[model samples]
Target: MGKVTLITGASRGIGYALALEMHMRGHHVIALARSEDKLQALKAECNDNRMECAVVDLGQPAQVDQFISALVDRGYTISHMINNAGALVNKPFGEISASELRHVYEVNVFSVFELIQKAMSVFADDIHVVNISSMGGFQGAQKFPGLSAYSSSKAAVASLTECLQEEFGEKGWSFNVLCLGAVQTEMLAEAFPGFKAPVNPSEMSTFIADFTEGAQKFIRGKVLPISSTTP
Candidate 1:
């Protein structure tokens, strides 16, 4: 059977490309996002039931929890889980409200934790979790403006990925954090204006999707950086 893959933020950008690439690889993909319209368009583009769409907003974990429960009821076991949904904050730290920071964590870090918790409860031993992090989490952590919340949350996510890797991955499962550089996405556009996106979403997605699909072969429990700077 094809590997069952579920990707968050699947409406556009890297997520959309990842969904399409996974379906092309013969994996049964559950493309998730908040916009049902984009999901419909994604479904139309794929034209295969193997590429299904789930309306989920990661910031709302209760809804995602309910959706997971329903999938469990249907005996659907996800082989791969990609935590790709996130929020961006571009204002000064003082200007960024508490609620704004809270929601950033909610979507980027907290919801990932919740999803992993749910996945652990129901998924098989061979399941893999891939957390998509940012170069901002490591490099320019303090250099960028208005990145205090966004970067720190992703840094937390990177830490959580390591923790989860140590806990579950060392035993049997595969858990990884891929710290990606500037990709051609809306998020990148906001982070650094005028600098052209060094990476194409489709190319990035294809590389990362393949990496996610066969994580056990190359990596086990670690935070690896994928950047143009890397040889």
Candidate 2:
């Protein structure tokens, strides 16, 4: 078996594209998502011997436990992990509910931690972790009114990425924080429809998978103007 890559939210959009790219590159793609049917379809389309699926809800502890248990039972070892599962809610800061905030953190930040915990069990000497932060991660960025919850969660993740970088870099484990601008994804379309950012998610996925190969490197940024305006 080739090196295994664990990708959360791999059923569609960026995660899905990333999985396909890696799978085509001869890497074992371990797809995880809430939609088993979608993952199944993806597996069938790729038909690559390295492609596999594990239905998981990044926000739920029970689901993650079950998925990891199955992987271990099957002697699966994960080498690369992209904590990409996330959801966005647009509401006034004062109107956002405590439950809603918890839900966002559960998937965006918490799930990444749990998956890393599980990944350590089957870690190789060289491992790369890419945490998908947002342009809002940078200090002094305009977080906007409705996205207080999401922007805050992404910021917290960026901070966590820094801590991880310092702690793990010395040991040769690398973690990078990728702050993306608007990309052509369902979530992006819903978030900002009329003016879509020029960053194509499919291309972004390809860049990320190709960039993250070996060694632990720390790349941090905030408010990356990823729109075509720059390029």
Candidate 3:
């Protein structure tokens, strides 16, 4: 059997492109996202049975755990786990609400932690775990005015990746964080309406696919910042 890759937020943007790229490389992709319609569209685009999808709200940890359990019961061993699902609440720091902050953390930080914990049980030997973060959250990256909640949540993700690497790297698991720069995607557009991102989602996805597929073996537990411009 081909290696199984689990990708969250796979219905669109970088996640969707990564799913396609990985599928083309002959891997079995399990794509999860909140939009059923988009997920179906992605599956249809695959034009093969190699891609599976689930419409899931990653903010709900219990539901995510149940889904992982089902995968385990089905005798699936995941070789790659991509925590690509994230939420952004781009508001001024002063205007951010408690609920908004909670939601962002729930989706970006807590859900990632939960998924990684559950996935650890079924990870194949030498598995790679990629947690998507942002350049804004990365140290010394250009800061934006309205991204406090989202950026902080991503920062937590980076920290978590580092900690998990220390705990799990000795056991053949590679944990890495990709602190991505602005990409031309819905999320980026929503956050910065008039700004044009230097790179496209497909371009970023290709780089990410290469890393997760094998290139990542050269380094473990590293936070990589990728952008067209130096930060």
* Best candidate according to TM-score: 3
lDDT order of candidates, top first: 3, 1, 2
Give the C-alpha lDDT of model 3: 0.89
Tens digits of per-residue lDDT for model 2 on 118-140?
Answer: 66776655677777777665566
Whole-model lDDT, model 1: 0.83
Candidate 1: regions farther than 4 A off: 139-142, 229-231
Candidate 1 or 2, higher lDDT? 1
Maximum-lDDT candidate = 3
lDDT per residue as tens, model 1, 161-218: 8888788765578888888887888888787777687688999998898888786677
Find the 10 residues in a row with the least total lDDT in model 2: 222-231
Each model's number of backbone clashes? 0, 2, 0
Cα misplacement distance, residue 155 of candidate 1 (Å): 0.6
Better of 1 and 3 by lDDT: 3
Q: What ranking emerges by TM-score with the best candidate at the front?
A: 3, 1, 2
What is the TM-score (0 to 1) of candidate 2?
A: 0.89
